[model samples]
Target: MDTTLRHGPFVMQLGSMPVQNILVDKEWNIKQFIEVQSICSLPIELMLPPSWITGKDIDKLLSTEDDRLQICYRQFAHTLRHEEAKRPLLPNGRLHSDTLIDGLHSSKFWLLQALQSSGNPLHTFRRVKGYGDNYAGKGKPLAAAAFRPQIYDYLKYKIASYVDYRKDVQKLFNGEYGRVYDEEDLDYIRRRPIVPERK
Candidate 1:
């Protein structure tokens, strides 16, 4: 859409495509993966389009100035980056692609485990066959059936905020991360207390 913006180059082609076309396709794939992971890794109650918060979303309950919400947002974004950095590596030593279905399954499995260990009752939820099933299911829908609605909304907002922040950073820096936001700001975000007081 915005051809004026600079983008990083990718050498490989999907098939019969030129270098520019491949670059465009790669960029789109990256954005799609980010969006899918943003939705899939979160509780199912928060995965619906109606539950998603975007820059254009207006909500009376979600306030931009809320300190508690801001803390959660920062913590979530920091933790997401941390987890992504530690994703499983391929036999060739390259990090596994986030778009891969097996990788998605592994991510959800560990995510559920972490939630359970933290006293979350997410594991009680039944997993349902989701999109890309193709008669034989490759993955199950990530669900958190009994998770609190208000807390679910809060978590959804944090995820949406992080996704938006990442898109902005990637767009502004031409695929480079950690440049738009200063290192001190990132450190502050990462250093915030993991458990904030609920008020």
Candidate 2:
């Protein structure tokens, strides 16, 4: 009955077997596995502000002297850049996959909400064309053109699903994410609805 060995600083442990065999299969406390990082706060700023979420005119707010969007957008972009800069760069001058996932996690959350509601918060803030659209790669596939947004859309689909989103969010909090989808999965996701059937 000994839950003796702890994993790192987390409370997760391997329980000893009834027959006193240390070689027995490890029993994992799933609740502890989740609770290990439950204390960590989600990136609340990554979510759109209340006004934006409630269908207010974010573009007008951004245009006016009101600095809400300005301040929040600046912090969001700064955190994104900081996270990207901390990651190892690739030969193609792009940041690591971690940067891409972090960016998409934030982007998909904000953009999907905007797309479902009234205004385009991230798009208006960044002044990007079709930021969240073009999921099927409608145009050129080069660089950050249609291809990037397509991948972004795919990730958005993955995130919109509750089960997958929880896994990704857990990984996001843990500062690591495995591949959520593959090429075959992408083909199927593209054929499916843009907004996932579930939250």
Candidate 2 lDDT: 0.42
Most TM-score-accurate candidate? 2
Give stretches of model 2 more than 4 Å off: 1-66, 88-91, 95-113, 118-199
lDDT of 1: 0.35
Q: Give the whole-model CA lDDT for all candidates, comma-separated.
A: 0.35, 0.42
Q: What TM-score would candidate 2 get against the native? A: 0.21
Shift of residue 166 alpha carbon in model 2, Å: 52
Give stretches of model 1 more than 4 Å off. Answer: 1-58, 62-65, 88-199
Model 1 weakest 10-residue run by lDDT: 43-52
